[model samples]
Target: MIESKLISKALFSDKSVKSVNNLKDYAGIEYIASMNQTHSDLVTFVKSSAVYDSDGIYTEEPKLGLVVKTADCMPILLSDKKRIGAIHSGWRGLKSNILEKAIKKFDVNELSISIGPHAQSCCYEVKEDVKKYFNDYTELRDGMFFLNMSKVLKDLSEKEGFQVEVSSICTICNSSYNSYRENKTTARQFGVIWK
Candidate 1:
């Protein structure tokens, strides 16, 4: 199973030591070390480390859990109901098709996926250059470009034979949730998932 929570300082701190310990306690899953996320699309396959880091892709490992953290960015969860994966996918990661690549890594014919809260199109305005990266077939209007990342991932997952569930919450619009856009000068909330 996969579960996510907006971590608070009262629950844990940002420091590596505390974060790792807290994950173990809260989720009963060991801390597979966090990766140095550069927003790139490099996937890794982990087998034994309690904590593992990757830029994008991760294959099934023996670990009881995997975790990824996000603020305004998206947190993608993948699992076969046995092995689980967590990915931090922002605009850059999405363009790279990190989720698609991860799905390709598995040999199984089916899996379950979840796309967590993120900056939705309503608030995720971008520059023309960025918009140009999308195919012309995409729908666009009034100088605004909207990308349903969850739908995109769902479609991709279906193509690869995985069942997907999407959470219809926009972090920027939800004041209860932490958003980099809403609180530029404040601390960002951690989006953590583990199984």
Candidate 2:
């Protein structure tokens, strides 16, 4: 698990999906509320631990870790002093403006955002069909097109009056974390946050 400097309670999992679910052993979290994560724009306000059909989940309750699982998709953790949230942002989520929807739950000025490992521009190649959703963030290199999701995420968050600290680690480039694009792996890592 990787702890954040901005918020010590927030953690980005380097372990497998199964191991990360057992947060009690490592994070001392009593309950874990993980999202179903359909890559949609649904943002759910959570009070306790339960699976919700949402790509973004937030909580004001203490010890209830908001977990987001991802392979190559971005795992974003949002926290103020009292509330915490987690978001699963892939191409679909970004297109749907999932980050904008998630941050609206909290005071933007008080929000501290952290983006975990994901497929970066260096390896996040997309097809012509996917380019329509992100024309501003995509670039043509050689014969392939690459998407800069970090720029889209940061720009969106900053425009909302908050700053975002994005992780430099790219899941596709790092063997330590699972990458669906890199190896078609079914495994996913987790990002957790608690009040």
Candidate 3:
């Protein structure tokens, strides 16, 4: 488990742990709320511990850890200390503006965003179908296209008047984390945050 010093009360779990339930003892936060991410723009508010059917989950409830499970997709955590959120941002989620919808739940001036291990542009090569949606953040090399999720998300969050700290670890190239694009792994890492 790795903690971000810039974003308090959060941890980005690597392949060492497969589920948020296993992270309870390690993170010291027993109750965690998670969601069945569908890569949509759906953002849900949490006041208790229960699995939701959305890509984003946020809460003002104390000690309720909000967790987002991901393999290669971006695991993002949002917090202002009193309130916190976890977002599962994939290409579909990004195209739907899930991050922006979650940001609206809090005052942007006090929010801090953390992006965990994901498929970076270096290894996130995409075909024209996917690349077209992210033209401004895509790069073409040797006639192939790559999508820079960090740059895309960072720019989007900054434009909303908040700072974003992204982990440089690329899941596709790093063995510490699981990557769906790497090996079609069913395993996932958890990005958890709480007040």
Candidate number with greatest lDDT: 3
Write one digit per residue (lDDT tens) for candidate 2, span 86-130.
999999998888888888898888889999889999989999899
Model 1 Cα lDDT, one tens digit per residue, 1-195 = 123332111121232323444665765655454556678777776665544447543545444455566556777766664456667787788788787777766544556666667777667666666666655324476877765556667667666776666766777787756677767634343434444
lDDT, candidate 3, 1-195, per-residue tens: 789776878889999896677877777886889998888899998888899999999998887888889999999998884678899998888888888899989888898999999999999999999988999989999999999988977887768888789999999999999999999989998898876
**Residue 127 in candidate 2, Cα distance off native in Å:** 1.0
Which runs in model 2 stand beyond 4 Å of their true positions? none
Q: Which stretches of candidate 1 lie over 4 Å from their true place?
A: 1-20, 48-53, 57-63, 135-142, 185-195
Candidate 1: clashing pairs of residues: 32-50, 32-51, 32-52, 33-51, 33-52, 43-57, 44-57
RMSD of 1: 5.3
Order of all candidates by lDDT, from best down to worst? 3, 2, 1
Q: Which candidate order results from sorting by TM-score in descending order? A: 3, 2, 1
Displacement of the residue 20 alpha carbon in candidate 3, Å: 1.6
**lDDT score of residue 22 within candidate 2:** 72
- Evaluated against the true structure, the overall lDDT of model 2 is 0.86
Of 1 and 3, the candidate ahead on lDDT is 3
